[model samples]
Target: MDTRDTACPPTDSAPVQPKDFIRLIVEEDNRTGRWDGRVHTRFPPEPNGYLHLGHAKSICLNFGLAREYGGKCNLRFDDTNPLKESDEYVQSIQRDVTWMGFNWDGMYYASDYFEQLYQFAEQLILKGKAYVDSQTAEEIRTARGTLTEPGVNSPWRDRSVEENLDLFRRMRAGEFPDGAHVLRAKIDMAHPNIVMRDPTMYRIRHTPHHRTGNAWCIYPLYDYTHCISDSLEGITHSLCTLEFENNRALYDWVLDELDAYHPQQTEFARLNLTYTVLSKRRLIQLVEEGHVDGWDDPRLPTLSGVRRRGVPAAALRSFCEKIGLARCDNMVDIALLDHCIREELNATAPRAMAVLKPLKVTITNYPEEQVEWFDFPWHPEKPEMGTRPLPFSRTLWIEQDDFREDAPRKWFRLAPGKEVRLRYAYYITCTEVVKDDAGNVVELKCTYDPETKGGWSKDGRKVKGTLHWLSAAHAKTAEARLYDRLFLEENPMDKKRHGKEFLECLNPESLHILPSIFIEPALAEAAPGFVCQFERLAYFCVDTRHSAPGAPVFNRTATLKDSWAKTERAGLAGEG
Candidate 1:
């Protein structure tokens, strides 16, 4: 994707509205000079999976606020846990953040703050606010009671601070085996907030860190590391999803006890879309199980995947703006997302003609040896978009569905003895239907109205339907991939309708590939990531994986309408 072309277009230097909660908070904070009027923010992503649309919302919130308030947003990889994290994830995240048009103040990692975090943990232990719990993993789980019940304190809760500090250092030095001993905060076990029930602050993880490598064997847990990292960076507002609302108390308690420079932690509802799975684990399953090509598969919701499928960044930005930030959870219709993309493309994308599943049509009356040229505007509304010369010949290709041997009463497309306007070309009347030996209609023979050039009748005849066609002799052959949702249900994880393993609900028809799509010769040299609207068909992007220099492959980014979703629901109802 072209960053310059896809980013939010330059406005007239007017103040943007506080369209969402994050912006509203920033405005209020600025009015009161909170954090001394500093609006610094950060997009802290766990380097375990590819960034998805949910991450996009966070990116927009962090960077968009910084841009509007003249502050800064840092791109930090919260990579403390090395078990599931990797350098591959780190690279993909950087590429994704850049692709979304966000420039970080600096690239920092949580692992970079490990030594500081460990020292802070020691401070907590010395202050008698933390200890090394010798309980087994299972025993700790048993002691940490249910939500309605208060947890019981461990027998070794009062182990001297000196002893705790020694154990912690030894744990860091690889003296302890995994899960044998963990550094737990000495916060109240009877506290109503379960996270404060002697929560484990550091754990012995033998895995190698992507950045720090094997220099350290111990890692700080997210609950302990996140608040300290935010305080360390002097972040004004630590924003996160509502799932962390329960953990906020632990965040506050850890920073308050340590006397750290704490940032305000705010929770907003995370984004959920119908017919989509947003969980990082499930997304990985799709890739590992060969259910998807990779993180960038068009059917997947990963930012890279969607970009590969040709969704413009502007469209994605518009979507984030439309959804806005809210306090409660809700399922956004994927159709609304599709609508956002279509709305953006309709206003900006140049239209071109391409025929998938083309049916050959030969003008029998016209001389087969002759070919003519017609002018079509690249964009109908924007005459300044100029024109492209399309070749017109006796042999042409039209959409297969555009013709019906037995036409329905309401159908306006071509039929026997029916007349229609060939878009940007001429009026053509169907004269004969050529059949194969099996009595199947293989082709249609038509006659063009020579006087009706550029599809306008000189005598003022009206045609309700205009069909997009390409000359068979002049069309460039290419591959086109049509994409749909990855799941068959509105909420794929609904266990009542779908089993516990909802990955089984994967939509079988997520991708439909047509190898023989014919386009105008202009698209012959289209490079990967190139985007254009395929006239009446859909908006498309050149397939990044397969499309290279001469062999241009386009992926249907989105259709002109949300008919696929409607079709899915209708099919489900029929099944029911």
Candidate 2:
């Protein structure tokens, strides 16, 4: 199936004021003097992997809400897991967020609060609210019973407060080996919420941290560290995905026990797109298994990948706004994303002529050494965009797909004995078809009608088809990459239902590279990252990483036709 045809059709209703449950809650909080009417939020991401579309939504929401309320938002790195976190991921995250046109008021790392976090842990032990557990990892998991049954109390749950404090301090001092002992909150073992059943507050990890190298051997777990970080920063609202809804109980318990400044936590549905997997684990696997080029491979859904593929940041922001915030999760059709990209590019991208699969055509009747410069508008409707000079001569190149020796019944494009307009030039008729030794039609000999200058017949004759072409003498060679959906299945991660491995659902033809493409000479000077529409082809961008000064490599962004619009039109026609 062509997944390109799959789309979540947009409604025709007029735009309404943006109001979601989270917004309503924020309004109520302001009315009730929550956090003293100060609005502060943070985008806390773990620096373990590059940010993806899912993170983009959170970034927009956190930053967007803060901006809407005239508040401040901080960029915080949840660098607690040093084993997997690195400086590369940190730099990429900052670059991605900045590229999305957001500036944080402050930047921080969770490791910066390690000293205070340890002090808070000691405070828990002294208050008899937390204790050091000597049980193995498996033992703790086994004791944390199923949803239907109460968990069993740990054998070391009754340790003396002084002993627990000494053990925790020793753990911090690097006197204990990894996993020898862990600090757990002294919450009820029989609590209905599993996350509150003596959750681990700190664990011994001898690994060196990227930011704070060899500073401490003990590290605070995410659940314990996140709340303290939020409270320490005086955040008014802690926004997170719905998976952490149960963890909210534990978050509240830690803050309440320590009597720290509390922040209200709100959960919203995360972005889940069809035919794509946003899980960091799955993405990492794809990279490690060589299923993709890298984190920024245009095929992957990573923000870097999407950016490298020439998706404008404005388009992404507009898409997030259109999707809005919802309480329940749903699979967003990838076509909507394509629609957003096409809609944005259609208004802004300049027009250029490119032949992906070139077929040579010789104007037999035109003068041999003559070269006419025809003016073409950069954007037809947008006259202010101006125009560029297009060279027309005896020899030219047209798209191979634009010609057919044995034409179909209503075909209007170039064929034997057929006359068509050469875009802004005169009308031309194919006089003879040139073939190679293997009978492959390699070229066409055409005769031009000089009376029909500038593509309009002076004698009131009508031409049904117009084709974009470039003077062979003035055209430049380029490399064009045609990219498509990375995954073939609508839900690549549906292993149980589909009975197929995620890798098995990978689309073999996701990327097609055309090494010998021709474009107009005006585009030869096009700099890296310059985007334009390739006439009858797709919207493309000059590859920033590969393009040189005099040569440009283009990456296909999206096709001109909107598949989602087609689907919608088909549905409406059926209803009629």
Give candidate 1 regions above 4 Å deviation: 1-19, 497-500, 562-576
Q: How far is candidate 1 from the true structure (C-alpha RMSD, Å)?
A: 5.6
What is the TM-score of each predicted model, taking all chains together? 0.93, 0.95
Quote the positional error of residue 423 for candidate 2 in Å: 1.4
Worst 10 residues of 2 by lDDT: 1-10
Q: Which runs of model 2 end up more than 4 angstroms from their true locations?
A: 1-15, 569-576
> Model 1, 1-576: lDDT tens per residue?
011112233477875343565666777889998779898888999999999999988888888888878998888889888889999999999998888887899888998898899889889998999899999999999999988988988988989978888988899889889988998998888888887889998899898888888898999999898888898898988899999999999999998998889899988889899999999999999999999998999999999899999888888988888778888788888887898788778888888889998999998777888888888888889999899899999999999989999998888999999999999788899989999999988899999898998889999989898999999998999999989889998899898976656777888999998987999999989878988999888899999899877778999988887754476579889999
The residue pairs in collision within model 2 are: none
| Tens digits of lDDT, candidate 2, 121-174 | 999999999999999999999999989999999999999999998999899889
